[model samples]
Target: MNPKKPPVPVPLLMVIGIVAISFSSIFIKWSSAPVSVQGMYRLLFTSLLMLPFARPYSGAACALRLKDWLLLGASGVMLALHFLLWMGSLNYTSVASSTMIMALEPLFIMLGAYILYKERNSASAILGMAIAIFGVVFIGWGDIGLSAENLKGDMLSVGGTVAVAAHLLIGQKLVARMPSYLYSLIVFISAAIVFAVYNLVTSTPFFNYPAREWGIFVLLAVVPTVFGHILFNWLLQYASATTVSMNILGEPVGASILAFLLLGEQLSGLQWAGGVLVMAGLGVYLYSGRRKALKLQDSLPNAS
Candidate 1:
């Protein structure tokens, strides 16, 4: 018989994730290194930190196959490409438009899962996702713009969102069996290696950055990269990709508050309303999922 899984506190971990990732944008703004440089260092530091506890790297006997490692590598490549494309859009599109487009990630995950794996959502879950998305529109309502010139950037943002969704989807399969830190270490190392090669090919210097910038890189690694993102990776063992993605929608709310405290970025009245809606939607949706899961568990004995 399979061992019973440990109870993971999904809500709490997701809250931690939101707060952790909220610092990501701030770190990027604070860094002076090129995007590739900053990304490489962030992964490098994160992978190093996670290395000590990572089961895959600990020389323990594991069930990992060649295909498994390749899937992890693919997931890492997709994540790297998501960053490159999303950031690349900034040159040609408004930040608001990009944010809005990137926000489509949850939908992509849901749809992709349905198509590729026949995963389905409950009525309440679908409702929750829609409401959360509406809240995002309110938060970004003022920033969104449309123009002929933004086509390429808009497309890139959409593509980036899809790539990120795929990353999450890939993780859903393996997160159950792999040690959390081990999975994160592998993916982080993979991304770092990819970025390093890309930077090297393009002649981007990897060293001698300003101390202030390096500090920001370390913060980025600790905050968003590890606590924020890898925490999500860890949480996947207990939640569906769609649900996890929904939880991530909380980031804009947390990020806005962080920005106000750290960078003096203020939220408009509509954005505040949007934040409320996001929290409410997530609460309702997650509650629904919990109820359903409990119901299924209760039925298992009778069914057997």
Candidate 2:
């Protein structure tokens, strides 16, 4: 008798992971700490939590060349910047605005893949991108009445989205040749170092945070940074990037609900409509891509 293979449902895990990550904004908003300090503590706790799984020295062994190290380091820097910018945007704009803008990351990723990696972009993907952008615009309009401050926040969120997209694309390359956990370890350590230096330069007191703030920081690190990212990386082993990317549309909806229940923040009817559009667009894109990929696979020659 053949041995049975344990079932691992990747899509379900990815959904749960992303929903957990969506709560990160709520935690950040709940804590009364400075954004820089919050970012520092978040990275510190995440690095520590990841240490057991990553085993830095052994992970470092997986990087066989200077180019690999450079790519990993770049991804880490981009990730740190993404956090910094996204968190900072929260200070200037509503969480709804920030999250909706950040939801544009899939569009950036699609564009980046096309430009950088020469990946082919189909009409369905382009239409999906446009629809997603419209949804973001709708959400943004509902957040702050199109004021300058809100516009600034929207731009910052967009910048963060670009940074994250770059990190993902580069990270995909690194993970393809090395262990995912190892690559993640290097990225986290690098992000920690960068944020530490940034905190030092800006005179941010890292050690003086209140206990409650520390608790929230630890929660953010453990829940979103570590577990969320680990599950996402794991899903990549079973699913395509497009499939995973489309699932990210769930984040804003989750965040909005948490913000409403926890922080008493309310979303407008327009914003809800925007969220629906985002989900619909992403659904169409992912479904179309999967069909295309399956057709291609079916047509490929197989070995006897």
Candidate 3:
């Protein structure tokens, strides 16, 4: 008889996912296609790749109510906007600046939760938000001294982060009632449709890209969308949310290293200082938020 197989290593897979996602900026920077076109093809390819696995959750998708469908559409639109803005940022700013600004995503999500759901935050979380904002401002100020174009890129990156936070907020509502795979599939398809319509209206040529660009699209789909995000989500079943959040904090460091190695990117003193501040703030923010959540969970009458 064959020997029994060993269990999968969740920690190793999480590291793989982080590494895969760290390539996102590098691939986007390499593509010369219009941001919209790239976003469209990436989502299209991602949706196609996910279709096979999402089949098990098709029943859940089909059962979505009208409100759920509408919210899903909104979520998709936000995702498309995020891709457009974030990718567009690459044209103007350094990867270090862009990724550092994006490191504020958890803060944005926290603020969104407070605004929309009345979720209160801890004092430490607020302090973390302030520190992170200061870091962003520091980076932005440095960019302004460098060139207005760089500043524009930083702003666009901020907008993109906000858009993604909105996407997550919408997902938080629906994921409780449906499979995450189904939620992700519907959102990806919706974003693809949105991009398809935008491209058609703008008369953007879809198939005019060279082979290299096509490969980047496929890599974006397979590496980040499938291996990075999907794998991370799968690992969530085993890891604490705190562990996952902490791991995500490593992305900027990984991406900056990759950018330096692959694209000959370098950070200045100001950028380095600001980057450190940003990561520090994000770390505090995530830690406090997770602690609060665990406390709340434990306080409940039916505490696990």
Q: Rate the local accuracy (lDDT) of all candidates.
A: 0.77, 0.75, 0.74
lDDT of 1 by residue, 33-116 (tens): 787887888889988887676654565326788888998899889888777676566556644445556766889999988987
Measured by TM-score, how close is model 3 to the native structure? Answer: 0.82
Identify the candidate with maximal lDDT.
1
Error of 1 at 128 (Å): 0.7
lDDT of 2 by residue, 129-216 (tens): 6776677667656675577887788788888888888888887666656767777777877887888899899888878767898899
Better of 1 and 3 by TM-score: 1
TM of each candidate vs. truth:
0.89, 0.89, 0.82
Backbone atom clashes (below 3 Å) for every candidate: 0, 0, 0
| Backbone steric clashes in candidate 1, count | 0
Global CA lDDT computed for model 3: 0.74
User: For model 1, which pairs clash?
Assistant: none
Assess candidate 1 and give its TM-score to the true structure: 0.89
Error of 3 at 298 (Å): 3.4
What is the full ranking by lDDT, best candidate first? Answer: 1, 2, 3
Worst 10 residues of 1 by lDDT: 1-10
